[model samples]
Target: MKKVLITGGAGFIGSNLALKLIEKGYEVTILDNMSKQIHGEDYTKSNLYRNIEGKVKFILGSVENKEDWRKALKNIEIVVHLAAETGTGQSMYEINKYIDVNIKGTSELLDILTNEIHSIKKIVVASSRAIYGEGEYICPNHGLVYPEEREDKYMSCGDFSVKCPICDVTVKLKATTEETKKHPSSVYGFTKQAQEEMCMIVGKSLNLPVVAFRYQNVYGPGQSLKNPYTGILSIFSTRIKNNNNINIFEDGQESRDFIYIDDVVEATILGIEKNEANYQTFNVGTGVAITVQEVAEILKEKYNSNVKIEISGNYRLGDIRHNYADLTKIKKLLGFQPKINFNTGISRFVKWVETQNIENDNYEKSIEEMRQKGLYK
Candidate 1:
């Protein structure tokens, strides 16, 4: 049996993946700090943490700590580095925290692999769709183009459409392929890009198999409902459950490619088990774009809540206008396809959210943090 070590394994994707790996006869070890932002105050009592507490070898530690990596890597054959600080708005102000965890932590892992001896076979790092920033688009005149970050001057005036970098004309959003240009709009996205680059570079020099999965807006059961800095679905669900009005930002037209947790885990495992995935970066997503307003409406309908959905024209500095995966490469190479559509996935997610205790909605507090930083309007 292959022994696998998953950093941040107590969190949503990691926990779910850990359980699946264990069921498939793999020995799993978990290294996680269990951040209060994600797990709330009572982290040990949290379902995400408690779900696999006794089942796997659990270590309470942070990825930024070299000692933690050393301790967790012991006897591990496969390493899934999923630990990092994630929040587009918060990353702008909390610059040091994002770099230290995402960039520095990845460096430490690579440094260990380069210098230390171990039984490590492969490493799979969790990248993000945010790295693509505005992603790919088709300008009628210029063909395919990757636009620069949406300007605040235009966004503030209630014009949030992304323009072509070459022609400066309105471009149609195209499914962002693995070959798309990386122009991250946020510090968090920048860190993820750096992480992916460092791993690929080091993995090549060290003859290590590295697979970076650029996961889209991954959401399903066990997502952090209390964390206001990210996860729109969780935030909206919390607000609806509490009968609070749902606030939609940027005219609620900004879209994302949301992949279900099960699909994400299955895609990740394919990368782990397939040799074709070695030294490669693949976009793991459903290749379908769903708008923000649509998500809010669907959740409201599912929960049967009367909360008013308001399109506030509010815009964040580092937020992208739209991005969804191309998924052509992953499909061709790994024979992977998403089994859950948005509607089915949302239904399963809403059902899971209903079963859990509703958390206090701190969405506004996070918005205030971004507002104080002058990042949010």
Candidate 2:
């Protein structure tokens, strides 16, 4: 069996990928610290573990530690590096932590792989769409495009503006491609860009095969609803299940290319199989943008309940206006396509959430109780 080491294997995407690899006859070993707030209480009993129980080897450790990575590298043929601080808004408040984990942690992993893990042939990295900050540019055939661009346009200003055909109107925000520029607006995005750069530099210098996947909004079951810092789908699903009011930050017009977790895992596996994916970056998304309002409506319809949605005028810092991915490259390169549609995925997720009794007691108290019960072991 092929030995694969997946860091952050207890998290959402990592765990899903691990289970898939195991099913494909790969020996999967997961190295995760399980430090997220929601996972702190029942980290071991998390939905991830429950789903992939007894199928893979689990190691309790952090990617920030070099020794942990060195030990995990034994007999490993491929390394799937998915461990990182992923909160976009929270990253602004904890810049050091993001850098330490996302950037520095990646650097350490690369160092160990090049120096010690000579048996490892390929490394797959998880990147994000936040790298492309708010900017507008002209694309061939697509006309002018503006999704996360800055608010103040040169033409919008009174003077020092040139009037052009593509300059006046906002173009249809097509899915972003692999060729998209790296102009991250938040510290999280910056760190992801740095991580991709590190992978490129190390792969070129050491002659190692590295693939970086720029993930869009990934959501499905096994997400931690208790952690508001990650997974908007989980947060909203939990709130809707509990009959709590859903909070909308903006006018609900800001859209996102929400891809299912299964599709992300499929793309990842295909990336590892296709030699062309090495030393390259690809966008893993559905290539379909949906408004926040549409998501709320979908949930409401699925649950068959009237959930109140309150729109908050204030927007989070470093939050982009809109973002999506162009999956043309991955499709052409890997011959991969997403099988799960949004409605089907959401329905499956809602059914799974309904089974969890998070509203039986206060959220904090229940989490503490689970901790006392020793579910994290």
Best by TM-score: 1
How do the residues 1-377 of candidate 1 rate in per-residue lDDT, one tens digit apiece?
99999999999999999999999999999999999998989888889998998999999998889999999999999999999999998999999999999999989899999999988989999999999999989999999898999998898899999999987899999999888999999999999999999999998998899999999999998898888888989999999988899989988988999999999999999999999999999999998889999999999999988899999999899999998999899999999999999999999999999999989988888889889989999
Candidate 2 deviates by what RMSD? 6.8
Q: Per-residue lDDT for 236-346 in model 2, tens only?
A: 777777787777755677788889899999999998888989898988889888888788878878888798977654345466667777777888889989888898888
Off by over 4 Å in 2: 135-172, 359-377
TM-score for candidate 1, please give it.
0.99
Quantify all predictions' global Cα lDDT against the true fold.
0.93, 0.77
**What's the CA error at residue 29 for candidate 1, in Å?**
0.6
Q: Listing every candidate in turn, what is its Cα RMSD in Å to the true structure after a full C-alpha superposition? A: 0.8, 6.8
Worst 10 residues of 1 by lDDT: 221-230
